[model samples]
Target: MSFPKYPEYKDSGVEWLGEVPAHWGVKQLKYLVTCLDGQRIPLNGVERYSKQGSVPYWGANKIMDYVDEAIFDEELVLLGEDGAPFFDVGKPVAFHSSGPVWPNNHIHVLRPGDSAWVKSIVYGLNATNYIDFVEGSTRDKLTQSRMMSIPLAWPPHDERNHIDSFLDHETARIDALVEEQQRLIELLKEKRQAVISHAVTKGLDPDVPMKDSGVEWLGEVPAHWNVVKFKYLIAEFEQGWSPQCDGDQAETLDEWGVLKVGCVNYGVFDPTENKRLPDNLEPRPELSIRKDDLLISRANTRDLVGSAAHVPMDYPKLMASDKIFVVRLHQRICRSRYAVVYLFGKGVRHQIELQATGASSSMLNIGQGAIRELWIPLPPDSEQDRIVHELEKREADFAALEQETVRHMRILNERRSALISAAVTGKIDVRGWQADQQSRQSEILMAAETRATYG
Candidate 1:
């Protein structure tokens, strides 16, 4: 949908905002709003908890955590002072927070002197590009004085409320649809996981006689299958060495690189996660990744501690880091591709969780003993090969569907951002525009129904 431009425009004397409706007024942000800088609490002072509290602790980004208490109890807007980038339209830099928010020093809390300006200020800040006003090298910082000096485009108070109401309704609808698409993607992922779990744990022969696998996650297997400790199938397994190197430099094509833990985190090989080796260091050639090699993450969050992936491509000079382990398997005993599926499957995942050792608050690590000792229900090599082939074929269609759903979600989010920016910036007048949009939507729905009936 397109919006007509406002009639009779005048120069606003601001470069970013070229022109505005003739009747609109321009004011510096400082004069139009009240800055409550004194009300902020430091992050360390703000007690953090996991879903155990009532009050929201608003930081530079979304609610960083929920605490036991509230510092302020009224509705206000919070803009990032640093840490959060303003260029991202998807995650807005300004937040319209309400009801018992404990704001931190990383953001500026503001209340409009006129209650009517509340939503307008939020919309403007979110739409405005703020790279000009921020300071600091690592993280951009928006200083209080710079924020106060910024010019804001202001319309009539009543018109401000009208624009606010229009955006609130439209963005909410767009957000709900985006949420639906997101839920669909999650469902697709779960379906993909189920396919892998079934094919790897239970062979393609459903009518075959079954026996107890003795593993809780793998309840039953084909009668001929045997459950054995992982050590029996592995020739050897060991974590790789790490050499000190600056991580930000470009990687040389044929030089040594140390793989980060994320390479196997998502059940795929992500070669881009490696760091370039320093010229002074020499890496052992035995550690270099070869075609058909298997790798697993030794240290990660407990949920992903034992994640494994098969390397389908060979690399010249890449070796694993200490956080990841290279697996040398006896192929006669177990198929490599089958091993990938079983390690990431539901039942074996639980075993990995049980074996992972670390303080509850930190990253979990699985020892060589645990990886070797964990039991697996195995089929013969030929059956393993068949299972892998069937799963890959079944997942191909679901993966395509998931990719398409993700593209649709991205388009919806882009539309949401464009709609909000247009309504707030007076590029379009939204007063009573809600009813017009509703009518147009009804017409489109009616047209679709009429087409379906005729065909």
Candidate 2:
């Protein structure tokens, strides 16, 4: 395919050059964009409007979806004005004022001003990474002042359009590749989880005699296994400490006294993402997590409500969330590792659902009372340990695979961002670019192969 060509450069009065076209101008964002025109509604007024008006309301959470109504009906970009994933900008963020709700205080609406070209303005804002300007020690928040103060590199109107169209096409291609990688990661995760769940719940020997374990989700276990409730093997189950308005947490610790949610997986107490609390702190008697304890999440989104993790010998003193259940196993009754794997398996999770009750607003919980009554299948100690050890090895392999996938994902993300930044800054010339023209095709192919094989 033939590519478009631009006129030769004649030192068109610009300073930054290597690949920048000579005619482009460097300008401030304030000159090109204007805040949406309207009387900013009060917070309570906006809420009432959402209830009573006929417009679509736009907020940070609603960026990916459309609402019933908006305050206005123009093509505009909405930016986050507050907490949680704070100061993020929504790109391709056009919203037609065709619904019942309007933009809220948590969103700042921006429109291209007379001096600005809309497409270029959006791309410029995007290339500038204005979202990073939102400031806060916590997640980060954006103020209107910060929103209007970002810098922009400007080109002549016609040049701006050319740059915008070029960027739109190129960036879309990169985004498509990134999206493909994300989908692959998801599939890998599902497959990995399936492998782990199967090996842990059922022994490696497919020839073992099977029988119904009484629980429907559990399907069948070895004929010699006994079906019993998890509560029967535990000494006790209960909540940890209650942090009132004042709790003695002044600094974060690593060597560990208490295990926060980050340390232990709330439901199954998987220590994969564990963080340590300072050893100087006093350990709460009830909350102290011991080796072989099964921790379950009491509260979370409905799907993750009963997700669990097994605490291993290496890390024992972890305390989980008030939302987690810690099951202490009786040595003579069941093997802790096997019990942990069993509780985290599909069947036990299905059983926990029966005990869970609550409104649509939030899922109610199942605590020690409900946990103690849960029936589980008990296998002989030797068989159980053997099954657990095999499952552990498989789990380790899965974890390693997951980590490698994440590393590739991070690298791809960085490269994708860098590609956009470089191209937009005019660090490389692509004026005669063709879809088949690739400067680093070999490196990209190598990365793709590695990702496909090990990712």
Best by lDDT: 1
Which residues of candidate 2, in runs, are more than 4 Å off? 1-20, 36-74, 82-107, 114-119, 129-134, 244-259, 266-283, 313-320, 350-370, 373-375, 434-455
Per-residue CA lDDT of model 1 for 1-455, tens digit only, reads: 44556877888888776677899987888997789989787655213523337788777877766677788887787889888767664568888777888888999999878766778888788767576788887678899999887777888878888888877877777678779989998898778788788877778888989988887767888889889988998977878877886574326657788898888876878887888888788777778877767899988887788889888878878888898888878888887778898887776787788888764323778888878887888899999999888888877898899889988777666666666666665666656466445545333222222111211
CA lDDT scores, all candidates in order? 0.77, 0.56
C-alpha root-mean-square deviation, each candidate? 5.5, 6.8
lDDT of 2 by residue, 196-223 (tens): 5675556677898988877776678778
Name model 1 segments beyond 4 Å from true.
1-3, 32-60, 63-73, 81-85, 101-116, 134-150, 241-244, 280-287, 301-303, 354-370, 434-455
Give all TM-scores, in the order shown: 0.83, 0.72
What TM-score number comes out for model 1?
A: 0.83
Q: Can you give the lDDT of residue 161 in candidate 2?
A: 61
